[model samples]
Target: MSAQRPKILIIGGGFGGLFCARRLAKADVDVTLLDRSAGHLFQPLLYQCATGKLAIGQISRPLREEFAPYPNVKTLLGEAIVLDPDAHTVTVRRPDETEFVIDYDVLVLAAGMRQSYLGHEAFARWAPGMKTLDDALEIRQRIFTAFEIAETLPPGPERASWLTLAVAGGGPTGVELAGQIREVATKTLANEFHSIQPEEARVLLFDGGDRVLKSFAPDLTSRATQALTELGVEMHLGVHVTDVRRDGITVTPKQGGPDQQFAARTVLWTAGVEAVPFARHVAEVLGAPTDRSGRIQVEPDLTVAGHPEIFVIGDLAGREGLPGVAENAMQGGLHAATCIRRDLEGRPRRPYRYRDLGSAAYISHGHALLQLGRVRVSGYLGWLAWGLIHIAFLTGVSNRVSTVATWLASIARPGRFHRAFMLGAADRPEQRYTYSTSDLPAEGHAPGS
Candidate 1:
């Protein structure tokens, strides 16, 4: 081995990889962060982008710019199709469809999860998800286009079908999407449309659980339900969406409701998520097990069972009972970096520990729900807290300031949604599979001596 510092490879530009890169900023190590997307998306606020409340640019920052201050850290835009743990190499597929290999002394896997169709992968053709920029843009198109399409159709079920919006899964993403659609129909797009009354649009939220936001406390769930009811969202609880077609969906509600089919042209699927396919590759390469969700069963130190040099953090690791939220990724990334530093210094690596930083969800208009441990706040106060907290969590100073300004402007202006449908032509096209590490101007660092 040459007398150079150890090399680190971090995958996924989400919270885990981003945080892990930051944690190793001043360390005596070389880090290369890879992600398929060019930007590091603030996924929590992605609902806003889908709803036209915030532009995509405001929430996603380029990974290259995010880590420009750290000379030891480099950002590469590409996807990892294969991970060879025994060989300590990752095979990357670039946007151009070519492939290359990069060897590493240590690796951090955090490729994040993708929207799942609950065994109905065919459902994806009709009901797109709210996970990526493409997904958001596609949902936005379907939404606004539905409204526009409704204008021409004569008054009937066809018009109603165009007016209806069905959102699968009553989780945070589903709730936020439903709430925003309600606001648009009742308040934002009220006077703008001519043929069909926007207020007449039907917004449906379906969930398998008896209550929404199941991860939150009971009282908060009750509060959110009440708020959603006031917004005119039809909550179909104890329901399982069995099938999704181009025109509608089939739901089997546990409440003894008949196998009912809801007719709606627009659908958003936020029901479930499985780790990115790369996780399965990692599990296979490591001879490790994975949960039903396809997330790797990582050890206490956020590493594979017997591979101390390889760490799996964030949405890709499932052994820990941590929620797949931003907080988990942030803390888990930090833990991986700390353990790596310890190993480099000839010290024992520590077990990974996660800190529950609480959770919050923005409902609509001036309403929100915030939960910090045992305490729960709802309504406008919670909404205010949500705003402040999200702004604080944004990556950069400029992004934070501009995001606040843009948010305020969006709230003040209702006409913004009128023009969003024109930005993209496709309604949720297939994602591009890409990743890279060779584009860096600097020479690759030799592995640990």
Candidate 2:
């Protein structure tokens, strides 16, 4: 560690922190990036991984490999538990149950958001949200296992219940997931089962709102709705889910009509998200103010109100003035980096101004909704644009190639790899103790032991 150079610490390795660290790579400062995971995940493609459309490696890159050439930048794999602004130090807990205290001249908080259970924690037992790679893999296992279970059941209501898939939200993630599940059931798993035809599988997308894709234009939403419906997806709009259990879901329409219960084996929750717990620590430590959602409110420069040295970005920061998208997070990270450089050079800091780059979401095969200024495109052309843009935005060349190859394979064979299943025993901690080296013979030690 060089004492002469100023120390800049960034928390979280998502869009914001990674962008900020990359921008300050050549700057005259010591930059350290810390994240809970060893690899940086491109979250936009998580649904694809969950749906078995892409592998985990195709959407994630190792953090060390990503910043290997930048000697001034160091990476730490840990979870930030506390922030002490007065001492300018952050307390991070490592995976091995050890704590490390790192002091910084300037700190940037970019910890992202997590799934919001919305006071319904019990629903998590049946339906898990898509937030992390583990969550995606678990969901993939659940989905694939449901099909396997359906194969064993007799042809009746039980089979129907096993084949029914429910998505709780109508947002981009939910829509994409519902659409992808429909495609997987119809095209990929069409001929796998003997008793039940995969095409008969029901995919239901439920939303309390009247329309799907509420963020987009009405016409585009209509087109997406139609596209999904054409793909054999059932849309339950304007309905509030009163209860979600393992067997099915009970929903009541907004008009106070009769309660409806739909039998579904797998329910995916993509409704809402709240900032991680660390955001509250940042706020309390720096005395920074936050919005109602517990997201830090930053100034135009991405700095906390009373603390110029402390900056907050990404989903953890509430930019009421700007939209909370991945692009905005990247821009905010760049802005934070620029401000840090300016402060080091004894120059005035510039205000953070966000530029709208538009938004796009894929509904189904060769179909998407794109909004670019006044120009709104839907259908196959929009889907092509979405694919190209995502490929261009991916982090590494290998990831891009892998994603493209998978997409091409899907176009060619549809469901070439959907049959892959988790065959081993489930993860259990007690098994570890049973396989300890102490229980093994000295000359015949097990491979792992």
Local distance difference test, each candidate: 0.84, 0.84
Model 2: weakest 10-residue lDDT segment is 431-440
**Per-residue accuracy of model 2 over 1-449 as CA lDDT, tens digit each:** 23579899999898899899999999999999999996789988888888887788888998899999999999999999988877889899999989999999889888888887677766776688999997888678777777878899999998899899999999899999999988889877888789878899899999999998888889899999989989999999999777776678988999888999999988889987887888887887777777766888888788889788888887777767676678888888999999988877879999888888888998877788899889999887898888887887788788889888877776656564643545333355433322134333347532212
TM-score of candidate 2 relative to the true fold: 0.92
lDDT string for model 1 (11-48, tens) is: 98888888899999999999999999968899998778
Q: How accurate is candidate 2 locally (lDDT)?
A: 0.84
TM-score of 1: 0.92
lDDT of 1: 0.84
Question: Model 2, which residues run further than 4 Å from truth?
Answer: 1-3, 409-413, 416-419, 423-449
How close is each model in CA RMSD to the real structure?
8.8, 7.0
TM-score of each: 0.92, 0.92
What's the residue-level lDDT of 220 in candidate 1? Answer: 93
